[model samples]
Target: MDVWKLNLRHLRSVAMTVRLGNLKAVAKKINLSQPAVTQSIIKIEEWFGAQFFVRHPSGMHPTEFANVLSPRIEMALNLIGSNRVTSTQARAFLSLSKTGSYVAASRDIGISQPSLHRNVADLQSVLNFKLVEPRGRGIALTPKGISVARKFLLARLQLEAGFSEIYALLGKETGHISIGAMPLSRASLLPSVLVAFQKRHPHITISVVEGGHGELIEPVRDGHLDIIIGAIREHPIGKDLIQIPLFTDQPVVIGRKDHPLTKVFEKNACCQNSQIMKLAHYPWYMPGKGAPINVVWRELFNRVPVDIPNIPIMGGSVMMIRQLLLETDGLTLLSPDQVAVELEADWLVQICTVPEWMQRDIGITYRTNWHPTRAQSYLLELLNHHSRK
Candidate 1:
């Protein structure tokens, strides 16, 4: 169901009916006439093609569908944080906030610019807050507007989840999980889990968006992504986000198969300080600063009292780093799992493993308040099972 098209007032009435258990009470609570509340319930039930309330002589009793969907509706209403905001106003402001221009928002939403402006203005008037302001060419949201937008997006996610759960209850598989994948997760961990998950739940849709942690964190926080998989951060991020460690990935120094370091490791079983110092002469390829591997590289060289190797390229692209390693005498610190194919193909060789203390925790990050549907929970279970293997 396209949740944005549904009336917020009707949905709120549904939630209130679940709580109050009678149309008269629900109508009084929401300031609607009893017949209007009855009509609202009828409309919602018709839209879903299911009965939410079982009418009785005593009062209206909720059916199983209502029991499953009511909590989600409540959560969504709480996130929206207002009783006066209509679905049209929410849609209009969200469109404007996303496109950042009245003209573009109108074009995207298929409404005239004046109508879009009026809708947004009505929204701001109801909330009594400044949402947008004129920029050089377009408009920008105020800080308060951005916060409200995040909450509205989260509310939308909740409504979608509610309907998806309803579909599941009716023996329909229609859940979606959006993932933000970092470089390490993309190589093997995520693919294996996804394959296993798809086999078990073929109808569920899975989307994997690849990017660095810095680029993906905000989207996940804003409900655009369900979760992010990668190396866990060293310090505390905040209470709003939670991390689950799936496994620990040890860092390894890697180079092209025929590089000079391959010969150095061939003769020595253990890498000593001298062997480590030998790495100072070659150009290095590291991920951008603050990456787990980059931090380990800095620590490894800092302990040797040798000048840090010059880094010619800094990025998180494993393919690009592999090509650079094969073309030049450049070494990189990375998880061996990230380049398993290259190692198997004899294109790259692990020169030495970093100390066990240097191992980083690889895992999943998600919002603290997120309530995963059954399908999402199943995928997370698959990820944990595959990561352990």
Candidate 2:
């Protein structure tokens, strides 16, 4: 079912009923009739063509689908809330979450306790869910409440980016882009692009979060990151993400400058002779499972019928691998373009060439439906230009 067809009230009803354990408690907390709350949860189940919660003698137990959908639903509700919830109600909710106490929340927001309570009450009425719960003498959020609070806080940050974009458009010094940098992007492409981007748009703020191929996708998909720059996969990425090709990068085996493998290659001066070298002779640094590099590594090596060693190290941190390869005798497989800076600096040497078929497509991956503001789009344009250069 289309998510936009679902409203804030319906989501809150299901989330709260699940969190609080029963319809009667959820109805009382949200100031809704028990039947209305029951109907809300049923309507959500109908949308999915399956039940989210299993009704029992005592309470509703969340199904596996409900567990999986918890975060996504909260995110959807948060997006809807930006339009449906007032600034005061949102602030009250956010402040309560931050302080974890009614008195502290009121003080932080410059509102009386009763006013804060009323704001929260009104918000709950509109949302049809319980946000706060009795914790000792003060308050705490239910599971559903905690999820909603975190999403709303993050949504507020995403919203503020629009103001920066507006200022940047008007020629004022302002903008922010949270970038999730995958392993390949962290090396040559992103570093060069960031420098050029800063030179062109000095006022823009940029935050780079480094992660593996799989690790970087979710934040960009969820709107926590402005964009993710990395190696594009050959297989289908989810429909939610859009891939824009930048360039192709071939994998290469790298070692220390004075490594025995490089020494033999330079001495023989023959690629055909070098291609027969036994891969198991050396200690290896392997990428972790589910990383794109790991798949490429298995594909390249398995065809040759070599016993892949029990990896001495399995990880995705390029910086650590770079240092390990430089100091110790450990070797790693990576895109040559990723370590161009190191190679040029004479710290590492390429020992073997990657198969042409194994070359990875480097590109930009972002949420398919994301509509970038002028400044955000300007940053993307800069990235597109970087790929060309």
Candidate 2 per-residue lDDT over residues 13-55, each given as its tens digit: 7777767888899899777899998898888677656577888
The local distance difference test score of model 1 is: 0.88
Which residue pairs of candidate 1 clash? none
131-164, model 1: which lDDT tens digit per residue?
9999999999999999989999899899999999
Model 2 reaches what TM-score against the true structure?
A: 0.68
lDDT against the true structure, per candidate, is 0.88, 0.73
Q: So what's the TM-score on candidate 1?
A: 0.96
Quick one: how many clashes does candidate 2 have? 0
